[model samples]
Target: MLHTLCNVESGRLSRVEAEEEFTVDQLAAKVGMTVRNVRAYAGRGLIPPPRLVGRTGYYGPDHVARLTLVQELLGKGYTLAAVERMMSELPDGAMALGVFQTLVNPWTPSEPEELDELQLAEAAGIPHDPAIIAKLVELGIAERMDNGHLRIPNPDLLRTGLEVIKLGVPLDAIFILLPKLFAQADAVAKTYVELFRSTVWRQFADAGLPAEGWPEIQRTLENIIPLAGQALVAAFREAMAREIEVVAYEELGLDPNTLPSTG
Candidate 1:
């Protein structure tokens, strides 16, 4: 008996713990594919070659699973090239996007808490207003449940916004400011993603992305997810410090050259 492994989120499937093996025709019949298509997929390196035994070849559960996945993706309107790239046989574009989407998380990871409208306002130190609640929903900060409860996706973000509100920034200004800040963050994230696309992934693709090389590539991608955030924070802090010094010199009649030295 063969056990099929389904990774629905990533659109990948594999079979394991099976001793079942089939010839080309049988393999195609089992997966509801043609012999020619199976051979074509094998040629494209979409599926690993069948185990060789003398002049004959035998396909196993892995082939069945991979071919099934390909059929499913095709049925769902994936281009053949897109599928090939996902399998790392063709040049990567969408494939890289999918990889990064899986690897990267833009928001900070934290436990979410549910709150009612009144409780949410208490938490954020804001008044309970339906208009403001609508704004929160628009900003994706809270979700309106069927029962009128609001779901806070990121409580830390709520606390941060509350602190900004406490610092004399008007609620209306916060709304306007958030979109611009998000746009800047999007641009920064794109830069880092493109850097990976052009440098790390391109080199890997050029090397034929061998079976043994995947672990290293995945590890590198995982490392980039956190490192990009850390690098961005370090870069932003230095930029902010310089901007503050210049602002003080111009607006506050302070000596920029007399700024406190870190050393």
Candidate 2:
């Protein structure tokens, strides 16, 4: 019997004997995949071909790990082609699997919620105005379902909109500002994405991404998510302050010296 240390939490093996083997059916059962799927994966080079053992073929721990990783990636909305490409990018090892897992794990803190039309309207502090609801959908603030339910992708944002509405901001004015805000946000997002691609991803790609460097690449990605969020918020705060100051001076006829320094 070959010894294997399975980390049940991650459904990955921390350590396993290379010689530990299973037949296709057994391997599929162990990895929670269908035997046909296992064969397909082998056929497509998603998993390595089993070792020839006389008349039968036998797969080992590496196959198990790879299959588990594939299932994980697929669960996270990756297509088979994308998973194949991602797998090809990493060196073959358990560490690579762990790194990819971390890289693909959910980074956002919020989960989307499904709400009825009344609930959504209540959240937005708005009456059942089809035009306004359609506007919200267009803004990507909420998604309308075939069942006439609403899926709020970010409840916090919805709550913020309600608060703004409560503060006497006209719904029309809010809707008018959303597209401009979204455009600016899209541009900012592109800049950050390019920064990550040019810096961390470029270096890893150029270095050929040795197994030893996987942790560093993973760490860089993990760090970038929260850091990028912080940077965006800080920049927005500064920009908002500056704009408010200008409005106070120009439109409100307030003295520049009387306004607080945005800097």
Candidate 3:
């Protein structure tokens, strides 16, 4: 008698020993995608391709997870090319921002360990200027505590400043830009707050609460913060491109002084 793998009543795969490595067929089955689709994604550079285990190509858990994300993003109107760019760019931007944060605003080790202006300057490894720090405080990106120490209102404000700088905008321009830009961001954040509060937070509530929420919060931020920044920047890039085109037209004014008018 011959038998095939079948799901019992739960309609889920039966619990079994999880494999550390999986073959192409197994990976395709696990990812709920076709073998051709997997190969196409690899060819298109949408994800890191599977590792070669001697004669057979084997995929690890990371590949499976990435494949799932790729599939979801594709279904949500993300083109393969865009998805590929996003996949690679997210990590690159995150790593770059991490370095920038270390330079600009290394987090204090713990509470009750406040930074005076001098220590803050030393920790950030930047030249000190009371005026500039005052400007940041005025922007509400930082604030003075009751104890006469400066504190970051939120670390993300520093990260966002670094991201703006990473886009090649100068520091003076950034100081000008962030105030306006972050006002826009405040409106943008409301949508995501609704999304998380309704969906993700509810799901977490259903699951047993862990010893600490910070670890889960950090993991979620790792996924979200970079992606949110990328989305905002893509919009800004499009807007700037349009602005440049218009500026070029205005700069090349059609006035008789600048252009040869058609007679």
lDDT of each: 0.70, 0.74, 0.59
lDDT of model 1, residue 60? 73
Residue ranges of candidate 1 with Cα displaced over 4 Å: 1-101, 104-107, 254-263
Q: What 10-residue stretch in candidate 3 is worst by lDDT?
A: 1-10
List ranges where model 3 is wrong by over 4 Å.
Answer: 1-133, 141-176, 202-222, 254-263
Candidate 1: 10-residue stretch with minimal lDDT: 1-10
Per-residue error for 140 in candidate 2, Å, reads 2.2
Model 2, span 1-263: residue lDDT tens:
00011112222223345767999989999999899999998888887677897989998877888899899889656999988876655445566566556656756568877888787677667687778778888888988877989888777777777899999999989888878987986797678768877887777657655445657766876787788889989988899888877787887776767766666
Q: What is the C-alpha lDDT profile of model 1 across 1-263, one tens digit per residue?
A: 00000112222212244478899999999999899999999998888777899988998766776677678678646899987765553222233233333442344668777889998778667788899999989988888877879878788878889899988889999999888888998898789878887887677656654334445656776778689889989988988888887797879887777776743
What TM-score, to 2 decimals, does candidate 1 have?
0.59
Best by TM-score: 2
Cα-based lDDT at residue 172, candidate 3? 81
Query: Candidate 2 at residue 53, lDDT?
Result: 75
TM-score of 2: 0.67
TM-score of each: 0.59, 0.67, 0.34
* Number of clashing pairs per prediction, in order: 0, 0, 0
For candidate 2, the lDDT comes to: 0.74
By descending TM-score, how would the candidates be arranged? 2, 1, 3
Best by lDDT: 2
